[model samples]
Target chain A: EAGVTQSPRYAVLQEGQAVSFWCDPISGHDTLYWYQQPRDQGPQLLVYFRDEAVIDNSQLPSDRFSAVRPKGTNSTLKIQSAKQGDTATYLCASSFLGTKDTQYFGPGTRLLVL
Target chain B: QQQVRQSPQSLTVWEGETAILNCSYENSAFDYFPWYQQFPGEGPALLISILSVSDKKEDGRFTIFFNKREKKLSLHIADSQPGDSATYFCAAMTNSAGNKLTFGIGTRVLVRP
Candidate 1:
């Protein structure tokens, strides 16, 4: 089976610009997650959804970051106004709801904000 | 506050030697622990995991030894190979936390051939 896939493997933007990252999860997976991984740091959970319903988004920066999984199979993470601090890799992961402990990740979109 | 902590930001080992990575967490409620391996440009992939019920878990050359009482754990990579050179992250999650993972800073391992 194909693994999770992400679009626009890389992105470069100036401060205050907007960018969006898209993700297509593995087939038959019902749980999707978005994580932010800064250089030299571990992946931190930003948001997650289960079958079109958001399970948790407390870690997400509501002022500038937003994510949605409308149909539950695909997800999009958007940053309305990028800042230098937002320069990091955005990763999307998925897992079966029954086996949520084992998550598979995508290549991730590397964003650079100047 | 960083709930999860990893010791020795980096390590170097010979191909035939073993590489050990340590991890500790402050949350006593965390019941699931997973270790992830990541390459330079790729996202992390699950390597191994252990539940609070088990004190040890082994897969192939990788082993996880957990100490629930001390909230500490270690990942042992036996007979390390050059291909095993990558950043390893230790993560934890509670059974009631909706699968939210708390990850450590990660240890970058370099296996010399």
Candidate 2:
């Protein structure tokens, strides 16, 4: 089985620009997650969805960051106005609902805002 | 506030030696703990995990020793190899919290050949 896949392996933008990252989860996986990992730091959960319904998004910055899993298989994370502080790696992961603890991650999209 | 904490930001060990990574969390409600291994430019992959109900879990050469009372845990890599050189992150989650993971800063291990 193929693992989770992400698009645009890298992205570079200036402050106030907008960028979007896409993700395709593993087949038959119902739970999808988005995380932000800064350099030298661990990944921090930004949002998550289960079968098209958002389970948690409190960590997400509502003013600039948003994510959606419309069909439950694919997801998109968008930053309305990127900032220098937003320079980090955006990672997507998925797992079966029954085994939520074991999440598989993608290669991630490295974003740099100048 | 950082919910999870990892000690010794970096470590170096010989190929035949063991590498020990420590982690601790402040949340008492966290019931699940998972350790993730990440290479430079790649996302983290699940290495091993343990539930609060268990005190220890071992997989191959990796072992997780948990102390629920003290809210501390450690990952032991036996007979480390050069291929094991990577950043290891310790994450914690709660059953009631929608399985959202809170990760530590991570410990970068360098295994010398």
Task: List DockQ for all candidates.
Answer: 0.78, 0.78
Cα-based TM-score, every candidate: 0.98, 0.98
Pairs clashing within candidate 1:
none
Tell me the spans in candidate 2 whose CA falls farther than 4 Å from its real position: none
Per-residue C-alpha lDDT of model 1 across residues A18-68, encoded as one tens digit per residue: 999999999999999999999999999999999899999999999999999
Question: In model 1, what is the error at residue A69, expressed in angstroms?
Answer: 0.9
Kindly provide the TM-score obtained by chain B of candidate 1 when compared with the true chain B: 0.99
Clashes (backbone N, CA, C under 3 Å), per candidate, total 0, 0
- Could you say which candidate leads in lDDT? 1
Error of 1 at B35 (Å): 0.4
For the predicted complex of model 2, DockQ is 0.78
lDDT of 1 at B99: 78
